[model samples]
Target chain A: MLRIPCPYCGVRDQSEFDYGGDATVNYPALDASEQEWFEAVYLRDDPKGPHTELWRHARGCRMWIIVERNTVTHEITGARPANPAHAEVLKRDFELETT
Target chain B: MGRYSAWEIIKQGLTGNKGWERAWRDPEPKARYDAIVVGGGGHGLATAYYLAKEHGIRNVAVLEKGWLGGGNAGRNTTIVRSNYMIPGNTEFYEFSLKIWENLSQDLNYNVMMSQRGQIVLFHSPAGRDAAARRLNIMRLNGIDGELLDREQVMKMVPHLDYSENARFHILGAAYQPRAGTARHDAVNWGFARAADQLGVDIIQNCEVTGFLHDATGAAIGVQTTRGEIRAGKIGVAVAGHSNRVAQMAGVGRLPIEAHALQAFVSEAVKPHLDYVIAFGGIGHFYISQSDKGGMVYGGDLDMYNNYAQRGMLPVVHDVHECVMQVMPSLGRARLLRSWGGIMDMSMDGSPIIDKSPVEGLYLNCGWCYGGFKATPASGFCFAHLIAKDEPHPAGAGLRLDRFRHGAMIDEKGAGATAWHH
Candidate 1:
């Protein structure tokens, strides 16, 4: 079973989760041609290596998550919300709590 | 005594009554049993029932952690077929199909075993070749199977948008006439009641903690939530949680991983699909329109192993994309609901029904979403192994060492491409 990390319920068994395939698909613009729209929606590149896929927490919190997984080893490297693109790099001050 | 009909028993089994709840709250078995089968799903209960009905072993007990059929059996899409690619698998599953035919009458329950036919579409030439090999094997094994052209398939499933412009190009398919989906919970309840009537004790909400062993390294009894109970033999029919149960027995250390598989249903609409369809190029998206006028579908599992219930959006989207491609009109159908269930995926994508090194301990696991189809045959084979202390001819080659000996019966060729295929 996949170790799916639910944003609300933390981590749980894959039995309680659903899988979403390739996460890089983008909808075509409104002004695009019919062929372009078809290509955008129907075409897909099923990668065999480390790919960012989509997942849902069916049993726990109902949140959409983007899971970066190695399809070969069934190892999940990272996870985040279903963001289409990365945010701009920003500089931030690091705070450390030394307890 | 008011004789309860099969429907009444099924209703009580699915929607537990007040008595059912009270009995489950404090379940206590008889003083002793000749055999104890863990996991009161289809296989466990079927084994218990068959042992009492066929083998005359009435002193049997079926232990369930939760309600009957609440596990994978309830969660399965309930597609039953024996059109396997190998002779051994094909023969075994064909036997299961026969049992499925007479199952309703035998159990005195209305299982609704619909033989609406099942077809697997192939998009690529490689897939076509593989399907051809499987079809040939099925035919050789005396199974009712055939290869249909694209036109034939389109005529059979009229709503299928098989135009060349479809997302996945129109291709021929392998059709099996005997394969069909059935009511999942009814089968479980039918077997449960049959076993109950045959003097097999059914215990619900009884979680098995560990196994009690004798000095000779033999499993004497089980440690459960209620108390200790001895048995002459034991069969572990727990599919998804096989590894956990095997670990308790100190055996079954293979490259088996527990994965969560998901299924979704669309809102009830006019019935469109009449047959079960499978897409080979896609992620094994096998689907069928249910009796409720909703498309009941499921696909391969998520890539990781975790006990989380909810699935990711990408899987749902991809699965919907495939469905929409086959029948573009369904693109507007709203998804009614989705659910997930655990599957014990072996490295070879096959099951292991063999006696372990542990004496008196037997295993029938690693089903990988195919357990629902093999319930009857699996139960029969396991019970035979336990009763006669030998493997049945149908399940003789399904040994644990087949993986080590390089004699794997990789039906989907999962061994050749463990990562991708």
Candidate 2:
């Protein structure tokens, strides 16, 4: 099991959190073109090396955090709060009520 | 290669059995070839076989980073079925199933294709409705499908949990009598031997490190660990490593992800489970009994994007719980072994058999968890694409541009996510 170090709850088991997908994707503007929105949402990257992804502390503090880890090695390099600026955009686009 | 037959076996047994030759030749890599297939799994070997047999292209090379069939070709649970629902997927997989029906005779090797049947059990009303829709589509396409009631399912599989106090009540199931399993290793060996006899070089341990591209950005050959080998055309049948291999030719990202899907086998017991059974509720759990009496089964993907060939404990735990919930009598079965195979999960859950953006480079990938069953058709269609410079009718819908064109063949109606599919 991956011991993810949540920014809020410290290190915890992987089962305690829900895997939110790629964090590097920046939500497009509300009035952006459909193609742009599709690219932003569907055309996500599957990087082989270190990647920044979202992880929700579902069984812990109930906060979303960005965790930078190597996908190949499954090593967590860093953790931080999710981009606060994209909170509303994520909520609207991803149907995520919590950030 | 020596032909395998009952008479030949008897003669060899009587004469000290020293005349058996290796299934394939281990030859040094040549300077060049007419075409080069990058992966030596079942698909690649079958591609070479068809390229020689059907297309009359005998000068081919199949390069493998390791031994043939060591990848997912030998790692899957060996379930074969064509009960797909979508247009593109349904036709293509049915073609594959047809090919598999005659594969042993065509290759002159016994693959042990068994049509024991399969059942996908449903718990909720919505799930049953979805299964009914899929069965309707299958029947319309000439594929056999039967909706079995709870009592019928109980008669089919008496060991299934049927108690009134069960958490997920078994409502009904979608049964496909033609679906079954094949001997996985025999398939690899058969294809390799046939391709070798047709003069296709089966080169193992020859890892392609980079691509040899011309000034116009067309892949002309590959630089491998055994040295550089040029080819007029290149076909990549690498499953999970498709994205990494494409990067060697300067192709950008792919709509594929590599995630580990693990399989498990239990200690051999008495012959019990006769049919391949699958759970269609929450977790993706499927089980079947091997010929040796071992219970071979697997669950969902590890739920992470990684190339690791081993999975974590949570999936194991989840699979165990589901298996016990379904077949409570098997709770005492001892676990023997488990291994993972990296799946090339596509954005739309369907496979891609198309020419790459780079000229002279063909791609056959994004098989997800269905590669084993699609081996023959994937090879036949991919060989057609690589040889004729056009997609075969059976696989025409699996275009690399489908994701951009919004023509995605979303088999499970799961949008865009690799693991969800």
Candidate 3:
């Protein structure tokens, strides 16, 4: 089982979390071309190595986070909150704790 | 190497059984061929077999990184069914079922196909109504399906958890009488031996590293670990490694994801279950007993995007819970072994058998979890595409541009969530 370290809920089993796929998907404009919407909605760069994806701590804090993990080995490198504002808060809180 | 008949079997048995020959030839990778099939799994071997047998493209080569059936061909729970409800999938799966029906006779090899039937349980009235509609569609398509009530289900297959206080008690089931199991390795070997006998080279340890493209960026051949081998046409039917091979042809992102699906087998016991059981009420779980008495079963994908041919502990626990919920008697059954296979999960949980964007390249992948059942038709249609450069009638709906046209064959109707399907 994957041991994910949620930004709010230190660490927990993967069973407590839910997998959100491909974090790199950039949804196109509503009035975009059908081709652009098709590519964004369907196509994926499902790599063999490291993949940056989304995970939700559904059973714990219920916060979404971005995790960089290897798709082949299931080795997790790091994770941060999905919201940039929450990530900024984490950085600031860490700085305050250290200082 | 020769025809396997009753007379031959008896003669061999009487003569002390010393005249058996190797099933297929181990040939070196040739420099060129009429068609090159990358991946020697069941689909690829079947493609080569059909290419030679049907299309008369005998000068073919099936390149495998390892032994012929080393991949997903031997990794699946050998259940076969054709109960699809959609237009695109309905015809394709039914065509595959017909092929499976005649496969043993056509190949002169015993595939051990047992049509014991498959029962998919439904929980509530609404679920039963939906399943009834699906079965109605299937019947209209000339596929056999029966709606079995709780009493009929119990009578057909007993020992299920049908207690009064049980959560999500079995209301009824959609039973397809013709759906059953086959020997996985036998399917692979049957296709390989048949293809090899038709003058197709079955080359092992030939890893395709990249593609050879012409001036117009059209794929013409492949750069393998052994050497550069060219072909007039290239058909790739690699299941888990579809994207990696497509990348070799410089075909960028695909509408697919590689996820690991795990299967488990229980320690051998007295045969109790004769039919394949599918229960999606609690969690995705399907199970059937092998002839050796081991209960072969598997559940949903690890529910993550990983290519490792191994599963995590959580799915094991989850699957065990579902198993107990479905069949409480199996609570004491010990797990014999568990293995994983990387699945090519298409965005809409359907397979694609169409020409790749690159010239002279044909793709036969995005099987998701339905690869095993669709092997025959996947091969036949892929061979049709590679040989005639046109989509086969059964596979005509399976196209690379379906999503662009908003024509996704979403079987589960789950929209974008792939594993849900």
Candidate 3's DockQ is 0.68
Higher lDDT: candidate 1 or 2?
2
The candidate maximizing DockQ is: 3
Q: Give TM-scores for every candidate, taking all chains together and pairing residue i with residue i.
A: 0.77, 0.95, 0.96
lDDT of 2 by residue, B70-106 (tens): 9999999999999999889999999999999999999
lDDT of 1 by residue, B298-410 (tens): 87675555344456555676777777777778888888999877777765677888888799888888788788988888888888888888888987867876655557777
Tell how far residue B340 is off in model 2, in angstroms.
0.9
DockQ of candidates 1 onward, in order?
Answer: 0.03, 0.48, 0.68
Candidate 3 wrong stretches, greater than 4 Å: A83-99, B416-421
After superposing the true interface residues, what Cα RMSD does each candidate give?
A: 14.4, 2.2, 1.2
Clashing pairs in 3: none
The per-model lDDT (C-alpha) reads 0.76, 0.89, 0.90
Error in Å for residue B6 of model 3: 2.3
Docking class of 3: medium
**Runs with alpha carbons beyond 4 Å of true place in candidate 2:** A30-39, A42-45, A88-99, B415-421
Ranking by lDDT: 3, 2, 1
lDDT of 3 by residue, B1-421 (tens): 7899999999999999999899999888888999999999999999999999999999999999998778899889999999999889999999999999999999999999999999999999988998899899999999999999999999988899999978788999999999999999999999999999999999999899989999999988999999999999999989898888887788777888899999999999998998999996557899999999999999989988888999999989888988988998999999999999999998888899999889899999899999999999999999999999999999899998887777889998655653352
True contacts kept of each: 0.00, 0.39, 0.86
